[model samples]
Target: MKRKYNPHGLPPWLRSIRNVCGQFIVPICIFQGIRTLILPSILDVLLLFLLIAAVIAFQFEMI
Candidate 1:
């Protein structure tokens, strides 16, 4: 059996939200990234950087 391609199965305009999220996330990530690097002695900063890295990695996987 063969499957048919279906765009309607997906929600409408999901790409717009993803685009906005990608745009906003990059700068915040960079700022936090630098801060984390500068303040490695503080555990909170490191954890925040880890979370951002995980998110960016997931975005890479999606792309």
Candidate 2:
């Protein structure tokens, strides 16, 4: 059987950083999405992709 992951096992500062990233990543992703839609630059698209991946990683606690 696999053991469940515990977030509380992380350091306080790391948890706070994760919390901050969780709070801000959504707005940044939204803004990047709008920018990508409007301008559609390669760099912007790549950045948006990375930001989205980060959001997913955060969601899954894979970061």
In model 1, state the lDDT of residue 23. Answer: 74
- Give the alpha carbon lDDT tens digit for every residue of 1-63 in model 1: 976644345556865665666677777777777777786667768667676875775476442
Instruction: Quantify how close model 2 is to the true structure by its C-alpha RMSD in Å.
Output: 2.4
User: For each candidate, what is the lDDT?
Assistant: 0.66, 0.93
lDDT of 2 by residue, 1-63 (tens): 997777788999989998999989999999999999999999999999999999998899876
For candidate 2, the per-residue lDDT at 5 reads 74
Off by over 4 Å in 2: 1-6
Leading candidate by TM-score: 2
Q: List candidate 1 stretches off by more than 4 Å.
A: 1-9, 41-63
Against the hidden reference, what TM-scores do the models get?
Answer: 0.47, 0.83
Error of 1 at 38 (Å): 2.1
